[model samples]
Target: MQSIKNGLVFIAVFIILATSCSKVEDTVIHHPKDPNTTYFPMAIGNYWIYHEFTLEPGGEVPTGKIDSTYIEKDTLINGNLYFVYKSSLSLQWEMIMRDSSSYLVNYLGEIFFHAKSIGDTIFREVNLNPLGDTIFAQYRIMHDGPDQIQLPAGVFSVLDATNVQLFPKAVSGPKERIMNNFYAKDVGLVFRNYFLYGKQHALKLARYHIEK
Candidate 1:
């Protein structure tokens, strides 16, 4: 009886340990084997310059401008490492991102872009408010395929990832926002198009420097 009781206790302890380990494994976020293959490569000193333009109201005429984005540095946040990103553009000024094999995720684990196994419809939610209440933005991957694009920098083969934004119920504003980002392998974002409130804003890659 003593031996049997000891065996039973050992079995229970083994079960408990296995369950705890499974839970820990499920919570682990796996990093990619090769971060360079991601749509947006994150590394300090890598930079991209864009020729930004906005269509004139009720017309197709473009107001020529310029903008730039670069990886400033890397920092540890919430126990995870993320590359710091800065841009001269207004809409996306600063953000921290990391590659997670199939997706480029932000500090909150919200996907910034899907990198692999893309299907017809991939969706994610962005929290506009810190508490994740009241305000949110819905993003849907509208396209993922091969295409070619021309820009001031050069012409190249590219993979297109278009994201459409759906307005949140708590927000009172324009109902439509669409952003299209074209990324070339090795190089980062080559071109982008943003449409909102009857105006179209475009950013065409003018120059870039990617560190090996």
Candidate 2:
């Protein structure tokens, strides 16, 4: 009788542990920057706060920096990168006339955002400048589940401001881009740094939910 009782207790403990572990695995956490759209496709028309820039070199590790705080919006028109903002024409003119050897080009373009899957994460990409041979930025937002969007909590911000002045410091005023995503609710959006140089210098930056 004593042996039978001990065996039963051991089996009960094993079941409890297994159940606990399963529960932990099933918990879905939401991110803050997630657009809050999950069932069907969602068109994101809200203004985005442009904050950081990630830099990559030819043969070194990628780095990120926070240089400016500008707000902009993207308009979605028939799945096109369509939107416009003010231009720093004076600066562009100065560069064109004053510095003939300048590699700086004023960026004044639109964005068209779409949804795509990377592994298990649902992300949306915004084409910052989708024309010509211009170097533009892209954003990616991640989701937690089919109906929940997680905010940035454990996400770290890169604080290297010196990078913005590497070249002639090309500025094109405020700009906006249209973003569309199916994971708008679950996954907000994503911003990726593609090392035009190599993958060894690639890095990613994101904004998720934080429990403050």
Candidate 3:
């Protein structure tokens, strides 16, 4: 019975995803800064998706929905993106939902970019785990030209998607599934996705967007 319901939920997400608007292209865009320099892509007051992990394994998964919101406050001297946010998980069928309302949270971390000696690889370092108060960080490795950025095709990453990674790994449930849709004027409305299994749940997405 529980499995049936969970499967239905997953199907619903995809159905909505199929019809969601496409990503729009931005002719006026900014390129990434030099690898030697730290770049802050998020601006103060901008809201970004923090993340929601909803994968449950080896048992009946709950019917809780996870959502996130971020407000960029300041960039640290080290070039990390810092922001304030509120996240909520709602178990509509369970009474526990009332006790777990969204709360304000603070995060300070940097997106470290490193240029390797071979193959022109880029490495990103973040604080890592989001649960242990260790600061949240996600990393991505991209293949690039000496002067150009190459990222998986997606609206969320078109501008800065050069090997971008989202942190707080999604292991079991719905969150582990790589399905996304997002829109922005600069990057335009886009569809992006990621999926991971077992250990090394590194996530990546193909860029799809709609632009004028």
Query: What C-alpha lDDT do the candidate models reach, one value each?
Result: 0.56, 0.22, 0.27
Off by over 4 Å in 2: 1-64, 67-188, 206-212
Q: For residues 1-212, what per-residue lDDT tens digits would candidate 1 score against the true structure?
A: 01111111000000000000011111111232232465576788878776655555443344555566777799998777889877544434577888766576778776656656455455666666666553646565735433445566665556656666655553555554556666776677776666534455666676676677
Q: CA lDDT of 212 in candidate 1?
A: 73
Q: Model 2, 93-169: lDDT tens per residue?
A: 21010101211111222112222222222222322344443343334332222233221212221111011111122
Q: After aligning candidate 3 to the native by TM-score, how far in Å is the CA of 128 from where it should be?
A: 18
Order by lDDT, highest first: 1, 3, 2
Clashes of each: 0, 27, 18
Q: Against the correct fold, how does model 1 do in TM-score?
A: 0.65
The reply for model 3, stretches above 4 Å from the true place, is 1-41, 49-66, 75-119, 124-139, 143-212
| TM-score comparison, 2 vs 3, better candidate | 3
Worst 10 residues of 3 by lDDT: 95-104
A best-first ranking of the candidates according to their TM-score comes to 1, 3, 2
- Cα deviation in Å at residue 185, candidate 2? 3.1
